[model samples]
Target chain A: MHISEGVLSGPVLVSGMILAAAGTTVGLKRLDYDKVPRAGILSAAFFVASLIHVPVGPSSVHLILNGIVGLLLGWGAFPALLVALILQALFFQFGGLTTLGVNTVIMAAPAIICYSLFGRAVHGATRKAFAAAFACGFLAVFFSALLAALSLIGTEEKFFKVSVLLLTAHLPVMIIEGIVTAFCVAFLKKVQPGMFARPGMTDPVRGEKGGGK
Target chain B: MTIMTRRMNRPKFRVARMRRVGPVGFVLLLSASLVLISGVPAALAHRVNVFAWVQGKRVHVQAAFSGGKKVRNGTVRVYDSKGALVTEGTTNVKGEFSFGLRHKEPLRVVVLAGAGHRGEWTLSREELSEEPETPASHSPGGASTDTSPVPGKSSPEAVLSREELRLAVEKALDRKLKPFYTLLADSLNRRPSVPEILGGIGYIIGLVGLATYLRYRKEGKEARPE
Candidate 1:
């Protein structure tokens, strides 16, 4: 979810930008040369996923898909998500330029967290991988929604009620993304086992030059 | 025998990789279904939309998410053209807000829905004025003559009557065409088209390609020295 311009305090905005800038630097430094294509493709997927709205009751919520990106790209999710968000802001105005840093941190930080918590498990036994994938998807949305609500705390009154509502609004989305990610992980496991290999691991033919996780 | 077994597994691996294409196909299928489901006439994403118009001495505003859901109890602030805060209030349960026009100049109305959703609308000076142009002869007497129109019944009273009639007509017309206006706004907020999605993807690919090329060149330079 995007925090529109003028909704955040000056301190919040500045801090968000600083955190985002630091995250992007680390992400770029860790970005494997070979995985650039994967990062780009996932960035595009993240961009388009926002347009897919799944109707819940009266209103509809779109897919963020940041969980899958983070699981696959690790720290690369930062740069990938940032690029996608900037394009979305430019093309569709989903989020304005002024709030871009805050929006990027809101969506991308959870992805990085999911990667740390569930990334390796996604490459384990079939059942364990499925469980981890589901958790990754669910937790990613859960945390992002929480961070979004937190961003509004400084600007609005009744912070708890608004935060709860924001989190509840995304409950269905969590389920949908969990199922989607589980299926994607299962498929990738069967087709491209190399994708699950640790970053910098050397293949007999490709050596250590191969890209990210 | 081991070589033959490895050869056999290679084909199987290739086949499995080919089937990996299934995930890409699944994503496309899911996107297609989403497009079909959300293609309904008056649905949009979560972004807020606001619209306002001058009706009589008050400005009427409606604020809602792009999905047509009302933004109830949200704060609505009004500012004059000179950037001075004119008035501030909250929307009713119906996502509708109205405030008396304090100044004849243009006005900006901003709706701040909690959780960082916001919508805004601006009304030009012409839209707020009852008459488009001033009467050339009455320029000097315009200010003092507004309230004492009974003394000069012919000029000021006629203008007042015309203003009243125009407001009545505009109100009726707004009510009659309310559905059309809502529909137009809903369509404007519809999900991005397939081409737009493709364009975004293209940009991402191009950006990644550039990054990859730069990385490759840097690595090449290092390897040449080695």
Candidate 2:
């Protein structure tokens, strides 16, 4: 998921960076200072969740909980994910420092979309928050993978092949991430029902906080 | 009768013939000689060998070239145990690169450079028997010889000398497998632990707990409406 330096072409990289910056700006517009600490906590959770490596075939893959992030943070997920990626590049070297902007956009864009579309649907209607979380988690990862696949399409003759490889490569990891997020959301619901039931737990829905269905 | 005899004596006529050869004949001869000469190893005579060690998280690699044209753009990759790419860097203007590794694990360090580079030594923590005696000594008497090789030491397969590590890495890149090498290097650099994962999970839980407590506390205060 960490797009190394020199993977994407220059024009694509630059364009992605521009879009990411715009998205982050839009996401940050309505954030209140009081919500800073909670946002920071969510970002940190997303960051560390990627560290747990599970063995697959001859290699190992880690969890990327971009879906959970979107479900919890809503619009604020974009900025939070962007910050987390930058921090990961700088401190952990998970990805290259030079390609930080591009990587941020690739990972965060789908998360924002998922939060906007699925966050409310899963949270407002479904009493089964875990199931909603599961769907969001799976779809967000799938979308992020799709966006990456689309980025390479038509540019390289091997795009289709690489896309298949990448999608298949992430399937197992995505399933694991879905399960983890479902359980995490269930735990959140039990311990702090307000965190989800009250809209104020997140930036976009801070006024109403969480609205239990 | 004399004039008739002179008119009958005509000069003998001669015809000249020209022959042309096709280009294929010339090209075949040239290509054959090239194919014959290609089998000789003399064309690749010069290479370098590199030996590297991580001393107190600092990489110290020694390079010795076996007499050849100078190679450029050498690279080094350091990996941790889990096959993640930790660090990738290029050599300096001096054809030497030293990296201060941030990871502490049994690392696999790959030094890649161009052709003519070959490595001959692997220096793990246990391999340091005694320092090879060198004539270039600063002290007149015997100086304290540091003999312990660094724990995480790996040399590239082809490098015969320490200097050729850069070329090997570059060659690996041209082969389209530098990412795998980078992963190997990262695993050599950082020794990631299960505790780290546990701690990460622990931290997330701790934060959620704190946030939930604070949210309830804030809600209670807001209900009173001072």
Candidate 3:
């Protein structure tokens, strides 16, 4: 879901940069040294994930995997995605270098939103956790599609039409992401329950089975 | 049995080592290997490319996604230097559109593939010169027919011969150079190659190292004050 170069206006691009900077600040503040390696791995995953295309929808549709990144990192999704998007723009012109801010916001905002919405529910091995993971995966892309369309507001396109078109085109991607996110969460919960950040100082290994509120 | 007892005596070291091989590192290694095995750099997705060049009186445009998928029925709008719509049409099944221009005056061609996927190329006035780079002057008489002329055609032999030779050279050059231009345009918006993919991952790792270094430096400075 990369928006190409020279499409957006000056104001939209500037505002996007400002918001992205603010988000990254918060993310970096919360992200401790212990978490930097995790962020890096997730960022690398994001860079590689966009290369795999599903070949569905009006245009090219690919797996973003931002939902999983968000579920793991929350606000940390901002800086993580920023790194990946920068590399994508530099190496592969999927998005413009100037529009990096806007593109980062488009991908990261939904991820942060999804994490806030479904991050807690999917913190365990419960079936409910898997269900929330699916929804998180599905909704993250849905919100990202909406944001991408919204970024075109200052341009020549009609907002309503573009939003509807983008949403419909990503319909299959939504389902696919949902399943992928669920699978990752289930696997992580079984293997490393400590991956998901808990609110209190709960033992990550034992908390997964009995920490459900 | 001695080694087993030694391992049992070093639970602290084992726990410390576990911290090093965290779940994130495991996932990274697993995913990196998966990518290496899949060889996904061959076919990238979504990135759109628009290439326009001048040929005879018409400026032709080709619009396609990075993975060689043509933008079928994509809306193509051509605007002149003054930002006025000069020619507008939909790309054909081949992702091609051409419009005759009365005057060069520089033109911008924008292609909307669909759903906010847009690509554009500007055609400079100099490119649309009177003398087209392609074989614009070639007659319908096929290349084979050039050598064996009609027995009774009412044309001068010397003038016809010079003209025929020029046309033949133009045709050959155009065929050879056209692919070069297409290659150039494709690179302007290309899919990720194997080297690029590997390099990008390497860059991410470098960034990670940089962040950790900065972090340690900051902590070290604070500890020195204490």
Which lDDT tens digits does candidate 3 get at residues B102-210? 7758889999876557788888867876445344345435333654665455345544675668767756766777888777766665667889989999998998899
**Candidate 1 runs further than 4 Å off:** A57-59, A197-213, B1-42, B82-85, B92-94, B131-195, B219-226
Candidate 1 vs candidate 3: the lDDT winner is: 3
**Tens digit of per-residue lDDT, candidate 1, span A1-213:** 787777788998998898888899988887767777778877877887787666654345678888888887888889999999988877766777888889989999999899888977886999999999999989999999889888888887667887788778789889878987887788676755555434343221134225322
Model 1 docking tier (incorrect/acceptable/medium/high): acceptable
The order by descending TM-score is: 1, 3, 2
> Candidate 1 overall Cα lDDT vs. reference?
0.76
What is the TM-score of candidate 3?
Answer: 0.79
Rate residue B135 of model 2 by lDDT: 26
Candidate 1 lDDT score at position A183: 72
List, residue by residue over A1-213, the lDDT tens digit for candidate 2: 666443456787778788878878866764544554556666766666555444443223456778766666666667777777766655455555655666677678777776666565555533566777777778777877777666655344466675665677578767866776676566554433334422333444344344422
Higher-ranked by lDDT: 1 or 2: 1
* Clash-forming residue pairs, model 3: none
- Stretches off by above 4 angstroms in model 2 are A124-128, A153-156, A193-213, B1-187, B191-226
TM-score of each candidate's B chain against the true B chain: 0.62, 0.30, 0.63
| Model 3 lDDT tens row, A44-128 | 8889888766665436677788998888887788999999999998888888888888999999999988888887788655799
Give the C-alpha miss distance for residue B104 in model 3, angstroms.
3.4
